[model samples]
Target chain A: MTDMYDFFNFILQIRNFVIHLQCSITLIHNNNMIEIKNLSFGYLKGHWVFNDLNLTVEQGGIYGLLGPNGQGKSTLLYLISGLLRPNEGEVTMNGTSTGLRLPSILSKIFIVPEEFTLPAITMKEYCQLNAPFYPKFSFDELSENLKAFGLDTDINMASFSMGQKKKAFLSFALACNTEILLLDEPTNGLDVTGKADFRRFIASHMNDNRTIIISTHQIHDVEKLLDHIIILGKNGLPVIDSPVSLIANKLCFEMIANGATPSQNEIFSKPTFGGNNIVSIRTDESPETEINLEMLYELAAEKPSEIKQILLNN
Target chain B: MRNNITQDKFLWSRLWMHIKREILSNMKQIRWQLALIVGVVLISEILICSNAYDNWKQNDYFYNSAFQDPAQLPILLAMVALGLFIVAIAASMTFSSLRTKAGKINQLMSVGTSAEKFWTRVLIYGVAPALFFLTSVCIIDLIRCVLVDSIMPIKAQFVIINPFIDETRVKAILLFCSFTACVSSFFTTVSVYSPKHAFLKGVCIIIALQTLGSWFLFRYGNILRPWEYHLDLAYWTALGVLTAIAVVLSVVSYIKYKETEL
Candidate 1:
């Protein structure tokens, strides 16, 4: 009996190993799904929001785009999604220029803007009208997402409160199941419980063949789910690195008592109600800890050169 | 080449889907307004028919002698002409939502090509409303004729003029359609560029065009209307020019739509 159990366990382990290998292969195949090549864009002729910006977002994992107000985080997403044209350079998806907006290419991208107008129709009708455009749209996923948000697909969308409408729109956006999902300020109107559910839903929906880009100034809302964070400076240049690398290489975030003296390695600090939250360069003896995205954003905004050197070296 | 063909097929399918969606949404949005318009027009037509029938019954010989010829029904002609204005208004309303920043973002982010969006608006706002208006008019006229025939003792006959049956009526209809086509296309093009108050802009454009046209005619009327000037040739030339302008405007609208930025 023991020998037979061992053999069955071995067989199960082999099967699991094969499944893991397949997932990795699929991820490798979709690497570098979005490539932004020297993109320059601005709403006006003489002014530019992003100048000669280059970015590559690979498939799989959620990317948190962090920036202060007016840093053009949302604009970058729009340019990538082809909603706005770049003044110079191009954004390509799977080696095809997104400017063309070919039907097949559009089918793979979905964007949930910070502000939008849902037609005066029921959620069901809205989905019926739009779902056909995306070949991979999943009705089951839509139902699940709506239920998670405490919404019903049959409700009239026009009657929904702002938060409820955002929830409904986000549900539909995720249900589209496009390979690339661009979300701008997705957690803006969500309540506490709703925000938690939003994060959970995004985490559950992630797959090896998909990429999700979320742009928001509210860093804490999405900090936990982000595998990589791209912080855009006021000048539009971005410092892209993984949260793990950021914590391990350059900074160690800590909460000390208010009025504590600054340490030699302290890079930045901000006083909080209970304590002084601090960002300092990681020393040989300093242990790695959670990254405070808010501090990082503030530090990067104030001294982009210093942060850029650290991030680039890593 | 094979890949190009496949891409084109995909785009066409998506365009058809977009057109159907726009048609359904527009119908839902304007159904009540359309019903109200039809009701008002039908009631007015009924009253007019009733008065005409009463006059005919009072003096059958005089009515027959004065206006019994089978010319195009003036009321129908007038209604068709009014329908063109309605079409222009509808065309201007097509992209009214684009006036708002939120609405513009929603539209640009939606999964459809610029060509698909442009053509869908053209069909829904420019073509479909005109056809609907004409159909409503015909139905109202038929009801009017029935009521007049049944209520009058003199049995007044209201001849429903079919434009296709007579050459002159056909030409008049062709000219009217050409004019409507030009006006509707112009409004559609205006809607693409004027993000806010597109209808107002369209009205201003129409006023400007009319003023220019009047000035031209006033200045060159004598020179163009000499004894040898053929009116038919003038009409045809006008039609050709208007059609050319409409085509050019539509192409410009498409190009502008394709290059639109949020």
Candidate 2:
């Protein structure tokens, strides 16, 4: 019986080793794209924006950077894109530290900011002037993009409307063909059709070698497209993970139109239409209920520590 | 290994595409600014030309005394416009989308482009305008001088038409622009730091400095460049110091951008 117990103990130890090994491998590989550890940022001194954040995004797919207003959504994107430096942490890309400017790293990343201005030139002139910076910038692809936008390559972008301008920026960003693309408020001025087109563009363009992080208040614009979602807490670090898997195993989102208090099924509950609460439950399976991003965001925002607990449990 | 393929593009090249589209999409805006700038230049030119023509046509010193040397009129005209464009680009670049130079710096900084690249963009966008305006004023003044000479009996052929520039003056212009642009690049860091009308802030800073400089001059006797603003020597030592300071500040700003989370 003693020998048998030792044999069983050995087997358990081996199993644990394998699991740890796999996790370590995943963690190491995550650094291939972007890596952040113990990151703390704040605009003003002693007033923190985010603190003790740890995150990793592997090469490829789309990351939805979700947060409430005044939360660090755009700030985080800017930090990762090497636009803004973090006050208390390190951000590394492709094994290179971002504290120093590496053209190799910079050339690989492209950011389409919330607001951008184009110069006074024809669309073709714009292309002619800006296409050579990125090694992957495809004139042919840019032309195709222009066609898709119903834009004449020869025409001036100055003639475009706000929506058209945004569309043009999206197309141009895609055309740059960088490995990492950071988009802030990409759907701001776009119409429903334009938004749909953007979804399609994201879906079609996402490649294994490419990673995209889009920051927006409107999570619906990116919910379907994101493979991972990194939700930032005001004055808190981040919890980054695959959205579907997170929703399935860690939390369940459901809308309740008649709840007055904490339902037995709810880990978190918020009011919905006609006095209903969009309640979230701790679950181990995909919730067949509706995906209400607003509610999910509220849960994440209102209870970051709780969300962290859920993440820890997962 | 085959899974994660990445390619690079030149930032300026990519920026140019956006620039082209922007220019195309906002032709009316540009047209308006252009019309305003050009109108101001032409109207000023006409006033000077008319005065000079009257002075020469009258061939009367008593009546022409108000006209003060038609030959020198272009220089005066250029000085007035210099002041105008400075104010204009500041407000235009900051307040409106007309001057996208500061915005581009912020964007470039966000994208992690180097300080060198950032400055290059500014030079093309910011100093390029200044240079263009400088040359234009010189050319316009030279043309005015020719016209004034044709009309006036007082033909002083060697009246420094582009009085603000020369061999020695080029050094000053280069140093001045370098100093100003280094200062202006603060707009990028400031805009990123605050994230509100960053462009406007950049413009305000410049305008405030100019106004302060003028006030200082008015209060005192001589012009005040403010905080080592001038290249006093136009000598190699001063030039070297200016270049080094410009480089350090720009690089420092770029470094500052490295930490700025947009």
Candidate 3:
């Protein structure tokens, strides 16, 4: 009987070990990946854009990088994508320094700048030239994306208007199927329908292996799609870097009725034609609400310490 | 397949693809430049040959004296100089993609080793332009031979100026080639380094450095004096030094290109 009990115990231990191994593998596959450590960068001497900035971007989320004008939102995107080298530290993707711009790292990352120039080639020719660099590029996806944007593969990009060109480029960027996608002001020149298509296309294409960072001042266009928010403070420092779920849990965003008095718990507020849009700390009884990105940005920009303290306490 | 794409090391296939892409993307501009070359060469040759014909009709002795040796012809030397200037200008435009933020981002983010990209530009701007110029001139020279032999009042063996056939022509071509290589390499490096107006900056830098080098040589070295130096020895020495500097500058250009940032 004791021997039997020992055998049963051994079997249980094996089962536990197998489970642990599986968990470890899953964790390794899906974890915080891109790490920016002690990164100091500046365009000029003694005026740092990002001084000793440290950031870690987890895989598989749509990150909205937000900041006011001239605060280095685009600069940060460039730094992360390895287009800009830091002065003091490094930005690494999967433990490899991005500044090296190794093909391994670059192939997995694609950046769509706010402004760009397409060669005078047709979309097909452009893809023929560029698609080989990205191993995971899918022609079918390119076709689908282009169709969604109301563009054709045979159209000459040089003849495209700015909006149409943006759509085409964005479509190509998505079809590259890179792990990390960086977009700066993606929706700026996009038409109303194009913006809707952009959101839909991005949503449809997102997967567990991909992480998209969209840096844009046009909050409404991307607010619904963001899984995380990163707001840069003065000197390109991030004041709020948190998941949308956590943000919703800690703060409530809502519009007060026209006659309602100002709430004491309000962290930030702005008057609207119909009512006042306010961001306030969430109480235990309060239900989670949709994030008001504009209001939230104002709160973080105005009362950074207060917002930080509130989020930290939760 | 993903592993192949992610390989950071230099691969020949990828480099070849990059070269193809670079050429195809700039195909239109290249076509325009080639047309311009043909136009310029044709017009210049016609003008020179027409003037020579008129001179020949006026006086055969003066014409023969003026065009006694094709190798010593000022027109050939001037054509070579002009070709070299064009090469330098093309070299200065090597990093034109970096002029705009968007272009810079696109280029820097493109998936290829820096060596691959740098070598592509070197081949396209540095080496290929010089070769193309040489070929274009040779072809035009052939056309000129036919035109001159057929139309000249006194045809004095109007053969093509084949550098391979004559030692003097070969030496002159080599000297000009080396000088052009040096100029192009320097201009290419400046293109990688300068923020704006790279061509102007490169020209200014060359002028300043040449002046400084001449001043130092004149002030310090008596043996380097124009009258004292042996022409052949000085010529060979200058050619060797220029070639060495060109090689060094080419390497430096690659290094600068690899480390360039937006």
Candidate 4:
């Protein structure tokens, strides 16, 4: 009887320790807006875009969804919006399943796709019709952004140029004041000035209630803005990764001029027009080493395995 | 706790914007069609009312001409078309709504425009056109009444069908709009299934069902003369079965659209 009592007390002590451990973990994670588990999807009779793809995004940071022309970056966003159904897997936002494009889920999330064709109606009318859906959407913010972007509310949507269209879409997206924002190729049509403004808008509006995911092949535009990077590649390399770790440790790409041959450990290289070849190597370096996103993409595309090994090493 | 409809409450608002824009732009695109349809329908209504008046004269013109009641056979038959026109306009709008705002909708969905919002947009896209169509039909109806001094035949006969026909005129308008809503909802699912074009699907459904129905009758009844056959029970039963089949197909199409990824 005494031994039985001791065993019960031991079990109780272990349970208390586990509970404390769980509390600490919760404190460590304060702002997680989206969490996807085993998300695998494909159209009927087609190959899967992502199989067992697991990802989690917390709030108040810029996440770059980088991939080639098509590796399902856009598809993933569609899944989150419940615009597309997954053959298998589940998407949860703040502990709720995204099924049938639930209104609560929609009010908190906004998307801006690449191609756009606006209606013949004025922008103001458009806003009036769509504003009620987003509880946090602010007209003042929309007006301010429109002014900053040099967009006139009086102009019909059909009148804007492609760059102007993108600007309008971006401005409209920001006004939604959603907790989750999805932007696909937001900077593709913008001029340099517009791109700069886009970066500024992102920096200014970020808060606990919002998380922005930008999918693009223009790594150069996002290099400075991106805090976390998920690279989608199937060239026998790592499928996803963060920019900070990629630049700070595990991978290095440097230009080696003629007369200075790189060691065999060099992950990849090819002779260039000026006789200086760019080579990638697996190494741990301080993040002070600025990342050349364009060069990185090219080198990684050339040698996906080298990048994969670097990821595995980490 | 939460029903599916409430999730994308914002979508209805957004769709309202999209619908307005589509209606404005498409109205201009179909301006010629609108003018023609209105002209033709007005002329038709006058001709039909005049023919009814002529028929009354031939029959000694004693009954009071029904003007207030919309449920009379003559008006209902003329307006049996009202709902189809409304639904056709709604379907056309839906076919173009997503394509017009493709970038915005795609991006919005990624950002968390809920599926409910998408469905709401579909509803608005379908209904906005219907409301506009109803307005146009109403104007034509008013003109017909104004030009013809005698009672519009519809105003004469509807209280005979049901005495509660006092509200029949207004109810007809509402019913026309509602019938279009249901048709467009099904059309939306059809649109999603065949994004490039739905004309063929619509044609196929109409033709195939009709052909199959006649074939079923021949195979089941096998009667060449009506007087020799007493198959009213069988005929009604067949029609009921066919209608159930159509309903089931519509429901299935809706489910397919609900789960479609794009």
Off by over 4 Å in 3: A1-30, A261-264, B1-3, B62-72, B151-172, B225-236
State each model's C-alpha RMSD to the native: 10.5, 12.6, 9.5, 9.5
Instruction: Write down the lDDT that model 1 would get.
Output: 0.77
Report the lDDT tens digits of candidate 3 across residue range A83-162.
88899998877666788898877999999998898999999999999999999999999999999888888877889999
Clashes of each: 0, 36, 0, 19
lDDT against the true structure, per candidate, is 0.77, 0.63, 0.84, 0.64
Q: lDDT by residue for model 4 over A139-233, one digit each (tens)?
A: 99999899999999989888888898889889988998888888888899999999999998988888765789998987777778877777777
CAPRI classification of candidate 3: acceptable
Q: Looking at every candidate separately, what fraction of the true A–B Cα contacts under 8 Å does it contain? A: 0.43, 0.26, 0.81, 0.46
Q: Give the candidate number with the greatest TM-score.
A: 3
- DockQ (C-alpha based) per candidate is 0.20, 0.12, 0.33, 0.23
Where is the poorest 10-residue window by lDDT in model 4 chain A?
A279-288
lDDT of 1 by residue, B2-74 (tens): 1232132225666777777765655667787587658756765666565555565566555555445221255
Q: Which of candidates 2 and 3 is the stronger one according to TM-score? A: 3
Off by over 4 Å in 1: A1-30, A239-244, A258-262, B1-12, B24-27, B50-74, B153-160, B226-228
lDDT of 4: 0.64
DockQ of 3: 0.33
